[model samples]
Target: MSTKFNTFILTALASSSSFGLTPAASALPPVTAISGYSFTRSGMDLNYVAIEFDAAVLPFEVQAFVSKLGGCLAVPENGTDNFNAAISLVLIDTGAPEDNAAWLGIVHTPAGDGELHWSTIEGDSVYFLAFDKGGSSNSPEAPLGVALDAHSQQWFDVTLDDGSSNIRRAVLSFPASMLDCDADMIPDALVLALGLGEDQDGDGRLDWCAPAGDFNGDGIIGAADLSIMLANWGLGGETDLDADGTTGASDLAMLLAGWQQ
Candidate 1:
């Protein structure tokens, strides 16, 4: 995800009540780096990711963050990992840099967590940095080791200095099923469709990044898409472009703004 959004986008978001989350203030920090591991549950292979935001985000921040995504899901002990096309974020893969993906695999987070229907990405820098001290008492990875196992794949693995207090540390765990759109038995991919759907058509490649507000998946925001949104007005689902859980004035405004006409 981008460290920062452009002036116009940020300003517009600031004015809109589209997210419909609490506190009506910014809470979550920008994700700067990450790390990860793998696990199993009821025959399902899950992906786990350790997150390091630019700041020490609080618990409430997690809830607020999901509100931005249009809907929130509960995945018992796993946090909410599914990401729709509500917004953009950073994606990283521990096993393969090329496996780096977008969307939220960050399910139920005690602090940092989600399932991946799909999410969006505005920026990326996929790399692995490991500073494994192997049980050394003074290692920086010690505090963050739970999410960074010895045999796991990861993004960053270096010395966490006084500059790294880890108050910003959290984890993202998700089932491979949520992200294996490519059927590769792994969690990864990128969403170039900044203002569109998540993996539409399921061809992977995020449907090669669908056009803005192409709700019907016909590759454009046309009369049919607008009609669908209007039909669902005051409701939720894809028509709720702003992802506030209900199609209302904000969703209408966004749809109109992105209208192909």
Candidate 2:
């Protein structure tokens, strides 16, 4: 099993009434980079790239200094050793190399720890940073180590910007294993946002990434999800999984087909 952080703060925020986690907000589109938020993956690297928190979370002043907030996890391309199963994150300058902000206690894991889990990369240097273990010293609790033989499979360029419509990407590489790719690698935060659970295998892949008829995103198409579909019967939102621009009998039929899967 993979490690599970406290995630109390994130869960509270997620369950808040103000977030408007209706089907629309909860159903994360497949787009690589949106205007305000974007999370995508390539090979072993699941990139947060850029996360612009809404003004409701942080005031404008504190948010300005922040540029791109990126995190990545690398795993064996073939085997299941997951040598570098640990996840790490970094904050980069806003295209201005000299303006790199080294402020600690800013980036945090889902547990809301003051520090990132493993070593953080700044520029070309890698620094071994302590993990926020929520007052515990454990083995698996720590982030995964970087495999020495690991190297990036694909290249990514980060064109940093100051809150512009730019997506700055960060990549992590793994060993020279055969690339028989088969899963949609993504962060757990996105999984939870879509009502999926933690990565049970710790293999950097969610079991229910694209499950059919997950209208309510609770990982299942059940009564609650059906109710939502009925509520938005003729609308275009999360319930319209078919992208046919309507939530009618066709959509309802799909939900029924995948019930309790």
Candidate 3:
């Protein structure tokens, strides 16, 4: 929603709920270095998780209502009521503000303490989810209990947990459908698609994707891959290894880093 970081921090201190330090139900899956992507924006270098996969690859929360099928939400912990009502999970798609989807961590507001609350981000609007237990009384005045299936949580700790930032991170479970940020049939689980190409269609699958540096798709990153990276130097097509629209020193560094991988 809004990038009001300063106001958010102040409100969080005075808000009804604070689940930032709540322990996760379980440990999360480990993310290998090559399994995710990292980029810098607004002076922040976020190394978040992104990949493509099948519906069965990871366990997902299911519900009769399509809205709750495969998404993520944060709630209160046992005996504690205070929770962060708004958590914006930002997805970096196409490296553009409009293209990225906000999904986690980024909070806009806190409803209150101990009360379970949720939010949904459509095109550009933010709405809270309200339930009425199959009746016609679903409204903010009469909120219903939301079903949250926690397959696992608290899988990893933030190396950034130095108290400078008042937030912690965990790999929460979600329906594989959420991974399909573009709403395409293909799940964007291309863990190795880092800097592979534009992925112009934003269809969750990579374009001209090979192993991180496997240009020729020979299943290995070797001399052939190096040749390809150099051949297309200063270009912006398939060999744009960094996906920043250019193939140059950084791209060469990327290719060389993966030599014989």
Candidate 4:
């Protein structure tokens, strides 16, 4: 699709749309910190992060996926429309050694407002279709939609394009509700693992017990275990095995080879 930049900025409104929030054009959402993962680029160019929303999040409007090449796109406080036919999602290039390409896909609901959107990092070429509700005949566009199986997780591959020397970084964002929690009940071991209470193991034993406090899977909870836990400290995908957010020696020793005893 030909690249055309539009300057029309709309005010934020709490419309019936599920995507939510429309930040002022001048402002964007803060860069999200994705724990346990790192993004690096070989060249001096920039990388990008894209987000896809679940249809349940915005039940009233036609669902569309948006990509922000280098950063995040802020949803305006007021609702915004993606089918306006004038505005296109913005693309940012970090100037890495490799070219930047990405994909955004939206799945429509059979009868409800629950659609699913996904994004993949592509190189230099991306396409999307503009669809209107009520299923009317529309212009056949090259970027409208591609043949895909929504049921498969392997629909796209993340790799460098052939003959391209540029390398870029990418990130993904989804609503918190998308995650399925552990049976709606936080496990005690997980809780203690996350550092939420004095009960180190949830096994009714004090942390001083040889078997209870050894978190690093090591045979003992000594200074070595403490060092390991301190190395992986943080939340959102790190080794919060106990489900608490902090990392301490207790968590470290749990990694010891035979600490379970």
Candidate 5:
């Protein structure tokens, strides 16, 4: 697919289809210090849930649960035609486990209000799902009508409410394609934290998913890669993977090890 730049904002919503603020046409601010849950990238078709936190967002967390057996797309709220899309779910951790909930807010885009969207990073269409457990209440099934065998101890369906208002828990069904950025048969999330999808080259594209081992960042590990490494040899710089203050045989070995066979 051709490269196109898409802008997104970080907010306090847990649904990818939800963005609470205006979309900025710039690279997202860097993400530093994420805590709480483990981020794992997988190569097989399996079921797992990842709970992530961003220190920059303060008390907001994202929980991504994947079930290879089956998944669904996120649904729009009642009477609202706008589809809110987000790269990651923004949630509020209520200190108390029983009241914990994730919320999906409205999305703003250049094309008007729409769901949070991004080019398929992994090259597959991902099914999404959202449902209200009804504010402080628990439900065995989601209201959006998708059947999920929510057996993992890490997940629970809970709702947030203030007697008059209520919000629900959400889950996303992204295909294996969405997570694998390098096509090296590994999900990028497995190697780095979230926000690695930000645009870096100013080429109207995101370098977050750039393939690994392409030291020169030209999208390939070829002669240019070797040349670049050799040039940087004895000088600690881009080729210094070991970071021992110099690029030498050890760095060359590492570079060769990553050579695209």
Candidate 6:
């Protein structure tokens, strides 16, 4: 199916209108960086990386994204313990302007044995699969194989050559895409939170590094100043604040705190 069709199906599965369960504004959980991993030489081995998230209700689009990347559950022979593999994330839809579903990006080393995976449906659980040896050259005695489930998220392990082993573990948090704030989701908020633009507040100021809206300096946000931020919003132009994917209350609050004292 086309990316658009896949997104539509995911949206239908999640019941698009039921966004009430998510807070209009909330704090993102501390993101644990994917570690103990490195990219491969040809940039194809998935190894060492791990990703975990809340699976209570999976987002359809996110699930399709993971499925498109192609997941595998690797199993090794008796002696080896570390199993390694990698999946590529090259396809992205980047939905419409007003639609929050289009924002998608992959954040992991693409070449090594470290890999991350998730589903689009909410309420489901997050799964993990890792490998230790994934180079192009394989010994005739290598005992590594993987199994993948397209429907349900399950745990699987891959064995390596040295009699060592690894197990896939599930996580307990929602993916960035599932977060709903000011009509946008986590991806947008993350972009803003990262300070990627010069005019984060969209107030026409080119230098957003000053305290144009950050009131407390603690970095936590409030709504009073954000009330002044609804004027300008979009891409490429100046008036886009908060970078939370749109020019709305959430972005406003982020800029309001940075507003000049």
Q: Where does model 4 exceed 4 Å of error?
A: 1-101, 105-171, 174-253, 258-261
User: Top model by lDDT, which number?
Assistant: 1
lDDT of 3 at 123: 19
Cα lDDT, model 2, residue 237:
58
Displacement of residue 162 (Cα, Å) in model 1 is 9.3
TM-score of decoy 6: 0.22
All candidates' lDDT scores? 0.37, 0.32, 0.32, 0.26, 0.32, 0.27
What would the per-residue lDDT of candidate 6 be over residues 158-234, giving only the tens digit for each residue?
22334342212211112222222222211222223323224555543334243444333444344544443443444
Models sorted by TM-score, best on top: 1, 3, 5, 2, 6, 4
Error of 4 at 10 (Å): 40
The whole-model C-alpha lDDT of candidate 6 against the native structure comes to 0.27
For each candidate, give its TM-score against the true structure. 0.32, 0.26, 0.29, 0.21, 0.27, 0.22
| Worst 10-residue lDDT window, candidate 3 | 6-15
Q: List the residue pairs that clash in candidate 2.
A: 86-144
What's model 2's TM-score?
0.26
Q: Taking the tens digit of each residue's C-alpha lDDT, what string does model 4 give over 1-261?
A: 122221212123112212332221222222211111112223211112221111112111111213321122221111112211112222233233222222222222222333223221222222343323333222222112111111221112221112231211222222221111221111222222223224544543334334533445465656665454566675322334333445554545444533434
In candidate 3, how many clashes are counted?
Answer: 19
After superposition, which runs of candidate 1 have C-alpha atoms over 4 Å from their true positions?
1-146, 150-208
Off by over 4 Å in 2: 1-219
Give, for candidate 6, the lowest lDDT window spanning 10 residues: 1-10
Q: Write candidate 5's Cα lDDT for 1-261 as tens digits.
A: 111112223354232222232122221123321111112223323112222323212111222212121222222222111121221222222334322332222111122333333211222332333333342223222221121212211212222111222223332333333333333322344223333344454322236544434666777677878887887778955566554667899867866766773
- lDDT score for residue 108 of model 6: 20
Minimal lDDT window, size 10, model 1: 5-14
lDDT (Cα, tens digit) per residue for candidate 3, span 122-238: 112224332224432223332222222111111111122222322222222222222332222222442212222246644333554445667677878998888887888888655
